[model samples]
Target: MKKRNKFFTKKNGFICAFLAPGILLFLVIYAYPLVNIFATSFCRWNYKNFQAPEFLGWGHLFDNYIKMFTLDANFKMALINTVKWVVLTMVIQIPFTLLVALVLAKKPRGWKFTRNMFIIPNIISTAAIGLIFLNIYNPSRGIITEICNKINPGSNVSVLADGNYAFWGVTFAFILFGGSSCLLLLTQIFSIDPGIYEAAKVDGASAWQIDRKIILPLMRPMIGTVSIMAANYGLLLYNEIALITGGGPDNATFSLSYYIYRTALGSTKLNFARGNTAGVIQFILGILLVGCINKAFRTDQGD
Candidate 1:
């Protein structure tokens, strides 16, 4: 008994030794930053007071948040656009990726080649993708402008120069390119037991029936996962906007991430506390989104 206890003690000591570096890194890198951001959201910190944050009195603790909702037109627009993008991800990106994944799972002729081609966009950096779309939306030499002119003689279609057109241009730049999410769904689909498919076939299940009844139900958790990923991507969108529209013809495409950047560092009128408050809101929204998706998919319920 004593020997067993001594062995366990040594084993635990080794485990702690192995874990110590990671724990320390997490504290310094992630936890500390998170705590700092949350705490500083209630303080006054900006270019004027670069030394340290001054705490807003308890009565005015929520001044930044109140100003964001009540006075900051940019913040309101950014929040609205962010929510719309998140909704679009769920409505369009998720379904499109799932459809592509389902089609590829059947292993059609040249399906492997098709899958590789589809994933190519995902492999490319977002910066490169944004640049590519920027050229595509250019007024004079862009393919879109050329196509419009072909359809209607003398027509000049400038996507990035118009507010509504620019918002959608940013959306299309990144929305349908869900190759990574498709890959995750495909992996989940393939992991399903082969015997189940065989049995469904033997039971005279049509392909559509099998897909509707079996595949989709089993793919729910993975759908939830990919949904979270895509939604988060939408919520935190920045690169495409910066490259394609630069938040617009009239600030019509400002995402929360871009708003945070402009507020905190990019703009001359830096408001560190307000930016941090926005960060806190973004963090909370992310947590809520994950919870809602998990609950919708019943992921916590063991299969």
Candidate 2:
């Protein structure tokens, strides 16, 4: 019995040794920061005139939560714009990509060349694209005006200057970014059984009917996956805002992620406690939102 016990103990020790590095890495990289943020969230501390943190359980969460609805109008705009960002990106991006992919999958020489060309914008970095748009939107001596000279050089349209146009301006890069999604969907379309189409044709089904009954239904799982991913990406909405208008003309473009970043890192507003509080809240919200999105798509994934 003593010998058997020693053997089992040695085996367990070997397993633990293998696991230790991964466990330690997780604690250092993810778990420790999470715990620290949770602890700091409730503390009353400011960085300007250094004050020792004093824990006031739930106080920071309560204050920020209240301010979101009451005193801060920017919070409300952020929430609204976030919804717009998610909905528009998903709604426009997926269906458009699917359509383009379908065309590419159809295998015309014309379509293949066009498909490659469309991805050029995506190859460019977001910063470069933002800068390009900024120049295009420039009032005088810009390409937009230069092009307009062909018709009438007198169009006073400075596209990015107005608040309403600026909102859509941030989204302009999104409309033509890449054929990445299209390429992904195209592969899936290619994998689908050709016999399915032959069978539909034998049944006297029209092309539209086959697409409606077969292709769209088959693509549901992929579309759901894409939509969820799009929503998550939208939550990290800062680059366009920072590059285009700097959330500007006013606080019109300030997204939640950008808001938290500015509050934490800003020279004027250096509240570490509040920043940690926001971080904690963001972590919770991210988990909840991703959970909900995954749950919504889980039904389609069983196949």
* Error of model 1, residue 56, in angstroms: 0.5
Residue 100 displacement in candidate 1 (angstroms) = 1.0
TM value for model 1: 0.92
Q: Number of clashes in every candidate structure? A: 0, 0
Stretches off by above 4 angstroms in model 2 are 1-18, 49-52, 57-61, 110-113, 117-120, 144-155, 299-303
lDDT of 2 by residue, 63-121 (tens): 64555457767666766776677677767776777777776776877887777777777
Least accurate stretch of 10 residues (summed lDDT) in model 2?
59-68
Give per-model TM-scores: 0.92, 0.82
lDDT of 2 at 233: 65
Tell me the tens digit of each residue's lDDT in model 1 across 157-210: 899888888889999999999988998999999999978878989989998888
Count clashing residue pairs in model 2: 0
RMSD of each: 3.0, 3.4
